[model samples]
Target: MVDSTQRIRVGIGGWTFEPWRDNFFPAGLPHTQELHFASRAVTAIEVNGTYYSTQSPKSFARWRDETPDDFVFSLKANRFATNRRVLAEAGDSIQRFVESGLSELGQKLGPLVWQFAPTKQFDPVDFGAFLELLPKAVDGLALRHVLDVRHASFMVPAYLALARRYGCATVFADSDKFPSFADVTGDFVYARLMQSQPDCATGYEAETLARWADVARDWARGATPAGAPLVEPAHDSGAARDVFVYFINGAKERAPAAAQALIARLRTG
Candidate 1:
């Protein structure tokens, strides 16, 4: 059941971190050179800046040029698209966000993260309508979507079912601040780990990294790892799924190191 071809991309939220310079990034690493170096160290990077505002096509192209050939960039969709009162009315905003030169990233573009505010609840009729508005492709490039809904209301089976219907992945959030749930809805898995301890040098301890690596392997093999909060009982369907894991939030300064450590563990195994 294990899909050996399944890719496992371990990365941090963003490359521009002042604390990273002290350890993750080399000394005197120019702001422009940060992406150049970070891309080589991690398999992927999540573009958080795009969440705040729309960027130019030229900027996207430049980022694509800066990263390595195999590298991927997961972008957080603009807040304007998801922060509105009515979710379904965001069709125009969603279309604009997608057409805003994201195609320039080419193969380097990964999933588009639609992160809903924590206050947002799971309204099936309304939420389903919003999910329907997400385009399957932009500029002839297939788009993979990941829903990062934080409310406890999303822990319901109906939410995961809706994601499955749209072929969109529901985020596996590993955090205390938000409900930590891991359910595989689509062909791929998107996870955000936010429990890294600030005192720990590597954000997460070695044992924790090993545990996460095992979980990733299980996910790649299309089997839910034991003990993960599940919407339904876990079973092995013998179908493989691609997995993307990001070390984010909590103890933010050490996220890069945590990702690198996890990558190394996966590589050795």
Candidate 2:
């Protein structure tokens, strides 16, 4: 059971994958019930569709109602909000995205991920200005933001510092395709593990999942796990934190298995 105010959630990128119907979803399970079933298996999910387009409030509400009470859904912001040639001009787009019924998910809403293009390099003044444009609240509800900066240039400490200053979390992405930065920048930690291989039965070997579970727990207890890449000094306040870890697109077909394996490891411990 999770303690109040402290949670370690492990989940996949999204619940609506066709591959999951064969592996994760029960045989003959209805497509409409995928979210219902996936939520019961994992504590959280990252909503990827929102990154490409805006969804109706009814859709968000349905998702919230379909999931378990403790389940959470982190949404990726639309590309227009983060992909413009001039990011600062994205204010209106961001506002529209937020006002488009995100609050309908209520407490089920997790952090909003702002993923920049891989080609987007780190520019202190420009990036700082864009971060400042992020709203702290949406429809009277507090918002938690996570920056998924893919360029290797964003590995600098200044990027993390800017994120910390805005109380935004920087994605601790685990992938060789993109730079991995494990710095903890906010009250919570968000990680995206994208190295799972299709040939592996469970996406990740048991030993790897167990190791990640250990790291998840360490993060929950406000400690930076040993061996994690760090751009800033580590510190512990002795208070537990909420940690969200997602097995994202690597061997996309195996993501659900990887997430489920990690969840089982954490629960068993």
Candidate 3:
């Protein structure tokens, strides 16, 4: 499911922020090298631009070549695929995105995040049909999918059951603006920490970052931490799991710092 790199990865979303250019990238670093620099500091990155449009195969190949061999990427599926009213009718959009050039990344590609609009209510039949449209592979490369459901309607047992049935991970986003939960639904864990603060140099308070690191450790060990936000009991098959933690939203400018700090903590532990 994951590249043969480290079991746990810590990173931030996108590499094109102007604020990051000033603080995260080394001074005088060419704009073209931002991804190059960011990739070395963090093990994984959430490619947000892909959510707006499908990228060409050459672009994916360049991204793979720019990053370290062990680096990984999580792509957000295009809005065209998830922003529709009828989820069952998204087959063509879904197919176009998967065949767009995902195979170019090979194993370096992690999960495809299909994020629903906050107002999109969860319909069992429609949602099941949508999940069924997600292909298991593209061009002989195995693909992993993740559901980023935002509405409270998706916080039911049935939702988790459905996601598990398709073997797709549900995003564990730490955002007050969205329904935040850490219910495990797949073999691996994916979390988007949205509480990073601009005031804190490390994005998060040291204690909070340490807590997140511990939570990630538990997830990698195939368990959920005590008192974690959950809609149902966590599922752990006893086998170790791969964990992807991205510092996103909140204090966007401090994301790189937060990600680097979390990586340090994960390394020491």
Q: Give the TM-scores of the predictions, in the order they appear.
A: 0.97, 0.95, 0.97
lDDT per residue as tens, model 1, 30-146? 888999999999999999999998999999999999999999999999898999889989999999899999999999999999999999998999999999999999889999999
Per-residue alpha-carbon lDDT of candidate 2 for residues 190-213, written as tens digits (9 for 90 to 100): 999998999997898999988998
Angstrom error at residue 246, model 1: 0.5
RMSD of each: 1.5, 1.7, 2.1
User: What is the total number of backbone clashes in candidate 1?
Assistant: 0
Instruction: Supply the global lDDT for candidate 1.
Output: 0.90
Number of clashes recorded per candidate? 0, 0, 0
Worst 10 residues of 3 by lDDT: 1-10
lDDT of each: 0.90, 0.87, 0.91
Give per-residue lDDT, candidate 3, residue 209.
91
Best by lDDT: 3
Residue 52 local lDDT, model 2: 93
Residue 241 shift from truth in candidate 1, angstroms: 1.6
